[model samples]
Target: MKIHEWQARELFEKYNIPVPRGYLCRNADEVRKAAADIAKPVVVKAQILVAGRGKAGGVKHASSPDEALSIAQDMIGATIKGIKVTSVLVVEAIKPEKELYIGFTIDRAMRAVTLIASSEGGVDLEVLAKTEPEKIYRKNIDPMVGLHPYEAREAAYSIGLSDKSANDFTSICLKIFEIFNSVDADLAESNPLAVRFDGSLVALDSRITLDDNAVFRHREYYQVDEELSPLEMEAHAADLAFVQLDGDIGIIGNGAGLVMATIDVVAHFGGKPANFLDMGGGSSVESVYRAVKICLEQKSLKALFVNILGGITKCDDVANGLVRALKESQLKIPITVRMVGTNEEEGRKILSENGIWYLDSMETAAEAVVKSAYSRN
Candidate 1:
């Protein structure tokens, strides 16, 4: 799950990490008070989960308390990347002598923990990786031993920090690594990790993304970030696996592999899938209904293709879920369904009686779905 800057800073504080002094305020009056507490030259940051906040005019420099309140007022009600900014984080501005970037993330292809650091900071690391790959340094961590002192120190030195800040930098890196492992996070990054004039390291920006499967171990940490969009909040609230894509046709299936195949088959047949939605194995009617509703909710979606291979998931249950969804949601677009295994005939019969379209083969289903979408266009 994604969290706002304030939430990430709070989490950092819990780990004894050095973060800038800040106050989260929902109103202009409270913002003024926070600005006063933090003193002049504060920063008014829109508390949104989306990126590119700086480009959206979500971050502003306030030279005085009055300006802080004004900037906060402007940002609190503004929208950034479709997310309504209901609050702003008022933080003390810093005088940084140097800036660096440090991060820890799972290297999926490598199947190991990867630590990355760069002498450059305050920009998208991906862009940096593409343009100046030599500036970024990466090291693999052994899960059993954790990040050793020598390894962290080596990363710190590699990022171009002076020998004086090397130990402090290593300490911070160790703590960050601990946080990543403790929370089962997929990524933990701090851009512009500043070295102040006094030579103290502090995080200027923080981002943490936790593994969805690990949420079971950290339920308390799963508190919803108030800055998320309504659609995002609802998707998480419903616990439906969803990934937004860009295409005209929406493809959904019961398994992850099946969903991938559905998208691939559609693409092979000259159709682009708008999203990959999976109901997962052994889902109920409510879950299935939510999956369909979520898929149909996409404004770009021209049609839905549901392909399910029932082994542990019964075909009848899939059919019943589709029927219930059709009854509940007044979906105007056509849906093409393909069912295989375990009571497939019964599922096909149920769908036919409900005025829904069904096909036996995956290729035929994909063709029908693509045809329905293009026909409407």
Candidate 2:
């Protein structure tokens, strides 16, 4: 689960990290009031989950309260990266003498929480890792021992800070790591941690991604909102694992591994998958129908691929769901199905009777669906 920048900043404050005076504004009036309260030049930032907001014109400078109101009005209903912006963060725009990137996240390869720092900041860290690898400094903390103050200082100095500035930076790093552990977060990032003229550090931006598996431990922080898309909400309501993607072919499978493999297969055949929908074990006809209906509702979907290697979920049951859905719905997109386990013969017979075909080979089915989707396009 991800929180907006304003929420992340609140968390930072709780951890004793300094952040600019800011207000979470839901409307133009609130933005104007916040700008007046700050009594300084403010930055108006659209609060959306996706990145590249600055490049997408979601961040603007407001020199006066009226300007802040105007900026807020412009951003409130604007769409960025396909997500509608409903709120904006109005904060004092600090003029940083220097900018640095500092973050703590799980390094899957190292199997430890890694602290990353860089002299260069306010840009995509992935690009920096590829282009100027030397600029990126990394320290893998022993989870058993946790991050020590000395290690945090080492990271700070590695980024070329010294003296009082180094100490301040070290404190900020330690606090960020503390926040990461306390929140059971997968990632806690402060991009472009700004250094003011007085050498004080402030978090200009923050991002926190909590581990969904640990939500039960942090119930107070878990609140459902309109941040999720409609398809995501539907999947959540059905208790199915699903994620939307940017493509034309909708994918459905019985397990996570199977669904991922199906996506790879589709991509291998020069096809892009629209979504990942896992029906999970012991999937019923209703669940399958709902999944299919959700996929069919997606605009620009040329085809759907259902690959099920059933162990607990019977193949015939899946076939029954698909047959019923096709009969009841007016889905124009083509569908390719491959079922290979648990009463396969009965499943094939049912599909054949319903004027639908089943494939024995995943590779062949993937190729057929890719061709079918392209032909329609």
Candidate 3:
């Protein structure tokens, strides 16, 4: 879950990481008051879950309260990268002598936390990684041993830091890691970690992405307002794990690993999955029905795959739900099923009566679905 920049700033402050004085303003009047209180040049930054806000005209500098108010009035309701800006952060504007980048995230391939740093900041890290890979430094931090003082120092020096600046850099890196660890964050970043002319460092901008699986451990961080599409919202309301993707094949499974493997099989068969829907353990007929219904809600799906290795969840229940859903919807979209374990014979019989044959092998079903999805061509 991507929290607004102001929320990230609050986390930074909580961790004793220095940041420019700021106020989260929900209205132009608040922005005006914040600027007036600061009594200096300030930046009005649109607080939306979008990247490249500056290029989108969501960021503006104001030297006076009136200018801040004008900017805020123009900013509120403005859309950046398809997300409307609902609030703005007015902060003391600092002219940095140099800008740097620091971030922490999971390196899934390495099975460790990856610390990313670069002397070149004020730009997208992804673009920088692609365009000038040599300028950035990546360090894989082992969660067991944790980041050492020397390792942080190493990261600081890698980004061309030296002396006092290097020491400060190392400290901030360690501090952000603390926050990342405490919050179960998937990603934590401070782009344009500004070095003022007087040589003090401050986080000019900040954002954190929390691990959705672990967010329940930190309810204090939960926001009533999150960027969820209509389908996603519906899934959330139903207590189902669903993620919409850009493909024509919809996938539903009983477990997260099962769903992920199903998606991989689809891709391996030269097919794309439109969505991921996990029914969870001990799923009922109603749950399966809702999952299928939600999967069909996406207009892009040309085919559907239901892969279930029933244990706590019975296969017959899944089959019954599928039969009910397909018959009720009466949609022409093809659906493939792979069911095994716990009343498998009963499940197969139920599906066969509905003219839907069940497959035992996941790969075969994936291959068939891919062919079906492209058959219209």
Candidate 4:
């Protein structure tokens, strides 16, 4: 799960990462108070989950308490990418002689920790990857051995630091890696890791994404759960993996592979999927209801594509669950059903007799859903 910047900075401080002194403010008064207490030029940053805050006017610089208050007042209720900025971070500004980027994340392809570093920092890494790929460097780290001191030094040197600074930077990288492992973090990054004129380093910004599966072991992290959406909370509670998308077609399939194939089929048929819902082997009425509710919550949705190839699950059971949901839910959207294998005839009969559209092929269902959704749109 993604935590706010304040929470991420707190975790970074705990891991011995040097960060600027800052105060989390809920209102403009608190922002002024923080700036006055610090008695220095400060940066006012809006705290929100979305990225590109700068472009959205969610970040501003203040040279005095009055300026801080003004910026905070203007930012507090402002919307950044549709998310309201409810809090701000007032941090003492720093003078940087140089800026660098450093981050650690799990590389699923390599099944190992990967370190990303570059001389270019304070900018989105994806933009760098797309525009100047050669400027960035990636190194695979063995979790078993951890980020060794020698390796860290080499990485720092590769990023073009001096002898002393390289060693110091490497030490910092090692500490950050230790934090990632200890906290079970999925990803952690410090953008524009600054080298001050006095030869010290500090994190200008921090981001941390915790492993949701490991949250059970970190109760403290769970306490900061105000950022979760209702659908996300429901998906977590049901232990049914789901992802919400932006489209008009809701899809439910039995297998992950089948779900992906269904998505491809819908796209090919000129439709976009609203969500990825997998009922899996549990074709029970409760599971179906849960899946249907998830789909129904998508206000843009106009049709559902229920494609199930029942192996261990009976087709009639799937049909019955769908019928039961239709009876219970006040959903107005149409559903195009596609059932195959394990008493398929009964499933077809059940849907057909009820006047629910049942297609014998996935392609037909996709075409029908696309047409239905387009007409509604």
Candidate 5:
């Protein structure tokens, strides 16, 4: 589950991390009041789950209550990246002497929690990680021993921090690590952890994603984070384990293991998956039909990739449902299918009759769909 930035800031403050004072406002009047209360230059940020809000005009700076109110008027009820904004955060804007980033997340390959620190700023952390990995300082922590102070300091110094700020950053890293473990978070990070002219540090923004499996232990947080995307609500009602993503490729496969592998393969081939939709074991035709329909509901998809390893679920049954869903949908997009196991020939025959391409290898199908998706652009 993803929590909004305001909620993440509250979590940060609870750990004694320095953060700019902010107020969560539902409408323009509250923003005006918050701006007047702060009595300083403030940033009006849209409270949406997606990132890149600033470029989408969901975030703005206001020097006075009037400007803040004007910005909030435009921001509230606006859609950013397909999600409507119902609230805005009016926070005191900080003048930074330098900007840096620090985040804690599970490194699957290392099979441990990874602390990543970067001296670079203004770029997306993910992009930085992919493009300029040399600038990033990484240290994987053993869950049993926890994060060591020396390791934290090593990361801070490697990111080019001075004595005072490095010390504070080390403490912040420890606190973030604590928050990561205690909150059962899948991801927790402060982007642009800023150093002010006076040499004090403050987190300019934060993001936190809790593990869905551990939500039972953190039930209190759901009170404020009850809002779900329309797609997620629909998927939940349909009884599909689905999660929306900001990608153009749609993924569907039988079983959690196969779905995960399909998603990774799509990414490996440079295709972004639009959602995580697991069709589950022994899926009936109707279930497969509904799952495909769910992926089709996302109009942004350029191509759909389906990987099915038939066992108890017959490959031919899944194919009938998949073809039916594609034929019924108005928004006709490219699709690639890879099927193996029981009744593969019948499945291939059904797909071939419908003019949908079939590949036996997941990697080959992933490459085809990725190519089809990018060719459109």
Candidate 6:
């Protein structure tokens, strides 16, 4: 669960972290009012979950209220990285004398919370890690003891901050750690934590990803709209795990591991998977039908691939669902299926009766589907 930047800033404010004066606006009129209230050169930023918003023309500078309104009008309905921007953050555009990066996240490998800091900011951390690994400083917090003040200060000085800014930097890092633990967050980051000309630190950008499993503990935080894609919402309703991707082949499998392996197999055969749909361990006719319907509904899908290795899931049941889906909908795309394990013979018989052939091997089925997709192109 990712929260919008404005919401992240709200969390920061709750923890006494300084942020630029801003207002979340849904329209031009509200933007104009926010700009007037701020009474400074403001930055109009599209409030969306994806990155690279600045490069996608989602961030603009406005010197006056009218300019803010105009920029907000252009951004409100704009799409950035496939997510439509429905809101904008009108914030004071502070000219930073220096910029720094600070973040806290769960370090899965270490099985501990980690604090990461860098002298360089306002850039992608992944690129920084690759290009200048030494610039990134990290400290793993002990779960039993939590993040100590000395450890926070150590990270602050390692980032090469001036003595004047060290205390403020340390304070912010400690607060960020607190926010991370308190909110059950997977990640909480402040990119380009700005140092104003007067030598005060302010968070220029904020990002927070909460742990979805812990949502029950923080019901109020999870009340915000999820902004899920239409297909994703449908999958959620059906209790299936589905993720859309950019490809021509639609994939469905009984388990997450199987679905992931199927995607790898498709890619290995020079084919891309359009989506990942896992019907869970015990798939029923309704689940399979819904998954098939969702995948077939995707635009630009050239072929559908169903790979099932049944253990708890019976192969014949899966075949029944596929045949029912085929009968109910106009499936324009070709389908390739591979079924092995429990009740395989019965499953194969049912598929053959419906004029569909089942492949015995995943490799052959993957190759056939890849060829079919390319031929259609």
Q: After superposition on all CA atoms, what RMSD does each candidate show versus the true structure?
A: 2.8, 2.9, 3.4, 2.8, 6.6, 2.7
Q: Which stretches of candidate 3 lie over 4 Å from their true place?
A: 109-111, 140-142, 224-227, 246-249, 255-273, 299-305, 309-313, 326-341, 352-377
- Worst ten in a row by lDDT for model 5: 220-229
Model 3 C-alpha lDDT per residue in residues 245-362, reported as the tens digit of each score: 8888999999999999999999999999998899899999999999988888888789889999989999999999988888888878888888998989999999998899779988
TM-score of 6: 0.89
Candidate 6 lDDT over residue span 160-245, tens digit each:
98776888999999998898989899999999998888778999999999998898888777743346678788888788899999
TM-score ranking of the models: 6, 4, 1, 2, 3, 5
In TM-score terms, candidate 2 sits at: 0.88
What's the TM-score of every candidate structure?
A: 0.88, 0.88, 0.84, 0.89, 0.71, 0.89
lDDT, candidate 6, at 366: 96
Question: How far is 82's C-alpha from truth in model 2 (Å)?
Answer: 2.8
lDDT (C-alpha, whole model) for all candidates: 0.84, 0.90, 0.90, 0.84, 0.89, 0.90
For 1-377, candidate 1 gives per-residue lDDT tens digits of 77667877888889988999988899988989988988868888888777788898988998888988788777787777777889888888887888889899988877789999988888789999999999999999987778898999999888778766787789889988988998889999889888888778999888888887888998876767555446656766787666767898988788888888899999988898988787889877778878887777788778889998888888888899889877887877888999998788888889989988887799999988988888875
| Residue range 232-331, candidate 2, lDDT tens digits | 8888778889888999899999999989999999999999999989989898988888878777778988898999898999889999998888788777
Model 5: per-residue Cα lDDT over 1-377, one tens digit each: 88889989999999999999899999999999999999999999998887678899988999999999999998899888888899999999998999999999998998999998999865798898799989988889998899999999999899999878898999999999999999899999999899888777899998899998898899876633335677877887787888888998999998888888899989998999998898788888899999999889898889989899899878889989988888899546788888998888998899889887888999998999999988976
lDDT of 3 at 132: 99
Which segments of model 6 are wrong by more than 4 Å? Answer: 162-164, 219-229, 245-247, 267-272, 299-302, 330-334, 370-377
> Mind giving the per-residue lDDT tens digits that candidate 4 earns over 172-216?
898888778877899888898998887778998998888988988
